[model samples]
Target: MKWLNKNRVLKVIFFALVVKPLVFIILGLNVRGKNNLPTKGPAIIAANHNSHLDTLVLMSLYPLSLLYKIRPVAAADYFLSNKYRAWFALNIIGIIPIERQRRVRKTELFSGCHTALDNDEILIIFPEGSRGQPEQISRIKKGLYHIVHDRKKTAIIPVLMHGLGKALPKGEALLVPFNCDVVIAPEMAEFQTADDFVKQLESCYQELKTYCITTTEQHN
Candidate 1:
């Protein structure tokens, strides 16, 4: 039973594919731009983090089999433990441990990420190193830039989650029952050293934000 306590992937899969979608159906969760998702190999998706619900929404939109290839990079300190949630987080979704509190070799992460890209897998990255307050985003780190910059061959997609912050705020376990939006968009690419890289990166967030606003307007 020791190991059982550490493995929750099966349950998570059920929840993500079954229970959560059912919840969305019953509650009518709004998600758009799924067609923007690359249908084939080796891509990177960068998104903002607002709630635990963010991962579920993103993964659900990705095709089922590719779900197997998607690895979510999460904070090591928060998700690493002897507990079942920790085990599933580490083994199931393939966690990339990020030591935010300490200054570590940044290149190590890039090497691992590069290897994953070369393997033609999808990686989900939260640019905000730390989850921020409602309607707010933490300063995005360079990890995303480094990964996409180095692996130019891989498709890089920008995603934005809307209204999830109000549904579930930071530092709170209460997941309020409410509808949210997942805005998917086209692949954005630029040269590594291009001066427009910064604008391109910010453009991803801006597009997501715009999608959210437009969705809100349409619904109303």
Candidate 2:
């Protein structure tokens, strides 16, 4: 399927992004606490990966038109596994692929990312570089810092996806019907040092954990 068709994207979104969310809600899925989305300008979206579904779910959370503008940062190897991912990354998600093996692909991806910035696009990055449990957010790599440090112009927006880990946990292709929440917090200030950025990244997870707890408390 063509990932992005100016005319068809709206229709595709209707089915995939919109209808699915409504279905999710009918099945008891809803996003709570998106007051966290940055109000303006390009920002870095740093999130924890719990399942293969996390990225798509996150994209769905974005208001219809804005979804296409949010480019996902994905691994070249995985997203390029087939025509589907390649197109998904290129057209639908706008992924910047990084070579897992060496710096060659990394440099190319980094350069492409820089160009995306030139176009004023927001980027989504999974600091861990792969999927894992919500608790593993702290195990994040320094690549996040490298991206932010290089493009010091953008803000880093911390987002927490609640209930998604359980919705489609690793190794499961089927998405479990459940209520999901995407909590967004405002963009963070630039880090003073590389160490400081890592600290802040870890802190984002802590804050997300707090949000999850509070949400549970409210519902209970």
Candidate 3:
């Protein structure tokens, strides 16, 4: 897990010079309800997946101090396919890869996530499983629900991002400059079941979409 170790130098160089200016300055990121995030605690950030930029955009919103504690859960088959890709994913990005295709033991999947939370780190998970059409949220997966179920102390933060798919859509290498909005809702709790939690998660996405549309209309 040497690659997974928090490298302050790498994180500083990447986010300060690259991600921050690219996302917040050049691309023009609009964030709403950011105050809802706890200043410090173990959290599970559940958001819709669209573009590869989705993870970067989400992480950029966090304070620099907390950046080192953030870990994005990625697909093992895609991110760890080759040596170069694996190096970049584990070393540079500090992602926790999970086997999505082959049969993975439940213990294996939960172990990685549990360790992160146990260390008081933030875990970014896309419950949709994979990227879908831009701005279209897909069905929630059971992985997130299971993690939350086990780690009851960890807070669940529902996030909604718009325009990222268009900026760097699926299958496209180049990133087109586009304005994006990210809405961070209050931490959710009190769900009786995982299915109930999924419903609430979907609702958070829809509410954020509506807010984005309204804000856009007002600006126009």
Candidate 4:
């Protein structure tokens, strides 16, 4: 029960004892641009959504000591559908759940994300909004821009991932072991406008996705 309180100690222990092993050992990762991963917080990790593994793999990139500082931005409808799931997600996974269906102000929609960044925590956000087809990138959403438009100092790191969709696609719970690829871009430059920022982010995601696909073809 104590671990269900979002306890830092238990979090460290869980990532160390569980998540890391599952990510690295079972679902093997072939990571490129590992050095581009940020070591500190007040940062945003913008990645493509393919499977549930996307969040776990991104969080596992950080050190165990920094696990407490990692928050994955997830949808409230799916993750918080029930009390038990809400407890596990909030406590064990440490997600910032945002309501997708509620007609609320943009300020309220991302209040939790802003607070996390203000607290110097690293957020793992999927700009595609929700999971799409396996190994496919969807239209980049604008919520990512809203979270960072005012936070000038916050770093935005772009990451493109592949293979997880085939491993565990949306609407399925059974995970099939498959090698996954992660390509991380260096922290992106701050853009002056929301449109400019989202444009640059989308471009970056496309570039990474292309590189990943090309590299996979070469290996095969």
What CA root-mean-square deviation does each model show from the true structure? Answer: 4.8, 4.5, 3.7, 3.3
TM-score of 2: 0.80
- Best-to-worst order by lDDT is 4, 3, 1, 2
Worst 10 residues of 1 by lDDT: 211-220
The residue pairs that clash in candidate 2, if any, are: 29-179, 36-184, 36-185
Which candidate gets the maximum lDDT versus the true structure? 4
lDDT of 2: 0.67
User: What is the C-alpha local distance difference test score of candidate 1?
Assistant: 0.69
* lDDT tens digits, residue span 1-220, model 2: 5546674475456547555565456334345457766534467788878666667766666666565567778888887889976875676566777777665654564776676667677778888778865334537787777766766568788777766666666777776676666667677776778788878877866776665632322231
lDDT of 4: 0.86
Candidate that beats the other on lDDT, 3 or 4, i.e. the better one: 4
| TM-scores for the candidates | 0.81, 0.80, 0.90, 0.90
Better of 1 and 3 by TM-score: 3
lDDT of 4 by residue, 1-220 (tens): 6434646777788889988999999898889899999878899999999898899899898888678888999999999999999988998889999999999999999999999988898899999898977777788888898888877789999999988888888999898888888999999987988788878988888788765642323232
Instruction: Residues 36-97, candidate 3: write the lDDT tens digits.
Output: 86556588888889899998888888877678788999999999999998988887678988
| Preferred candidate (TM-score higher): 2 or 3 | 3
